[model samples]
Target: MTLETGAPENGPIMLDHDFFRDPHPVYREIKKNGNKPTEVILKTGMAYIPPGLKAWLVTSYEDIESVLRDPRFAKSIADAMPLFAANAPARQEGGGPGRSSLLYDNMANNDPPKHTRLRKPLNGIFTSRAVAPKRADIERAAAETLDAVAAAHRGRDGFDLVQDFAFPFSIAVICDTLGVPVQDRAAFNSWVQTITGAAGPEELARDAGRMAAYLRDLLRAKRTGTEDDVLSLLARSLDEDEAVAQAYALLAAGYETTANLIVTGFLTLEADPQQKRRLWSDPALVPGAVEEMLRHQSPFNLSLYRYVTETTVLNGVELPAGAIVFLAFAAANRDDRRFARPDEFAIEEPRREHLAFGGGIHNCIGKHLARLEAEVAFGMLIQRCPELSVLAPPAADAWKVSPTFRGLRNLRVGPVPGISETGRAHD
Candidate 1:
């Protein structure tokens, strides 16, 4: 297998460089054997692992979508990895808190009843209409972020879009939606950074607990009397534990995914300047372009850990009860069977079915919000900095390594010659 920094990964899938930087090639190799969504038992000497990465890796569009929609394909990370779940530090090392503090709380990775209960209260807020009013706000946030980047690089030619624009732009929208206290916003980034795979397990556990406590306290404060923000609405109904869960989900899900999308959208367009020109020429294509970006450049490589609820069969692959399976989102999006010229970037595809935000009941609740943010972000970006061009491929040496999430460490874009007149790039 080709790797980004180190020697080639000729073994099983671990956190290999080749897989992260341009995973399409690796994904094609997985399908080369013509046994997509193949069944295999991960063993030592074959797979190069960094620690507790043990699961049934699922690829192929049909199988991935099937698994995602299948009720038997469970999302219980605890039952799937019981040993790791019991060991808190090891679990944290693997990926933050386990069953007790996380699985039950995070609706994105849990099964029904509990999942239903957790997701019920805040569903209304994420719907398209509910999020419609925030379009102007998101646009403003994008513009403001671009403004800061412009100011910083006034004399200079370039800046890091991930640090200067993508992250800040996303965080701004989240802060507004959550009504995160002005004072709390500063500390908020520190807390989010800890969870973003920057801190070690011990630090992660401590930070997660601290952040949970902070959110719980914030919920309690809002419970007295509050407005229509999600937290305020949740505060009225949910207990501290429940409120903390919802708040954490909202905060984590809201910004990170959109931030990556923002970075990828710009980077992808930059890679293919002609496509960027087409998009810039046709403003109506912005929404469809966002869909294509989601399909082609999925931010999260795989879905959260899923356990087999019962005996299941997919394309002759027998999965025993309680077996672990990771639904491959990025791979499925590029499946040749599902997409025409699957690897190529097409702004306007005739058929585009992407699992970037997942599907079925456990699908991303904030997908509409994420889409809106991207629509405004790219639209504003093309308008705000027309001279913007990539210095190099936006791929980075350091990546946020998480089993569930994938994001660039930094994306350095150059040739930005200050903020341009909004209408100057009419070409």
Candidate 2:
């Protein structure tokens, strides 16, 4: 497979707004190139990565798995510092070429030893057994959020599922676990939005700093207090900066991704009536359905920046050290090699393993909790509001404009034809 670089004859595929809205077509096109690592440019004005950053994109399931599992493709951001230092635009004020907030000092960006050490403090907190007891609370939260939506939109045709149900419910679960006060959620979300949104480095740095400070204060409170939440555990187990970083990491990583899973999963099911019927027909299928939805419309479109630790040839393409690489989890989940009829959202596909939560060591630590949350949230929704249906296709503005994450900004929903608001079918 040939690697296209620097304005190839056909030009590098632009990850523009359209690509953000519907990337599968491009994913298919990329796969047509023999599933090799294709060079893609992160265009100007995107979130996460710096503008004009050229990263090798791996989409095939096997190739993505290789990058994710291979030690050669490292997560240590320091390995790519010189690359960023040369390519990134000069930052104003508190921001610089490679400057980022301390919140990023967590394990996700580190290589082993440091990564292993930083990951240990909060390792067991999100396991299925750990999160099982919280199911009742999660269900109640989901129920209450839906109830509020119904009340606010009384006699109306619709309410935004993303804003009314998914976002608040998901964030609340993570925040409550971290012992963040209910009143502080709004400001906390604002800071997180700015940090994760398509803002310049200066804005990202500022908001990230704010979030880091907030986490530090919360860690301090948890240290002296009797709360038995995740933050409290972190405070006790790690030093101040590391504890604060981990707390921010949990909040940042947990909330929006889970929220996206819910919205995107629902949308995917709605678009496929057969799967929707299957899900409602078999309540026992909820867990498997969650996996299918995760595979079908992965919350995270791409993996975090994995720097090439050293020169290595992957899929016949030679990747030099310090090159930025991204494993396209969303694309890999739908690769036909690993999954039969991969595009179809089949809960009974038999192959339950997908790269949605990633693979290898740095796989999501909160995988169990995320699954539990989605299961409880979707289970409650299916049981309580089976009549709910999207009123219209999401507008262009509805898709969040982020290079790293894929989710709706809003999704309007209400009872569908032949189904009453009480969830009973009409005669």
**Backbone clashes, each candidate:** 1, 0
What lDDT does each candidate get?
0.70, 0.78
List TM-score per model, in order: 0.86, 0.91
lDDT of 2: 0.78
Highest-scoring model, TM-score: 2
**What does each candidate score in C-alpha RMSD?**
6.0, 4.1
Error of 1 at 132 (Å): 1.9
Best of the candidates, lDDT: 2
- Put down candidate 1 lDDT per residue, 261-304, tens digits, no spaces: 88877778888989989888787898999999998889886676
What C-alpha root-mean-square deviation, in Å, does candidate 2 show against the real structure? 4.1
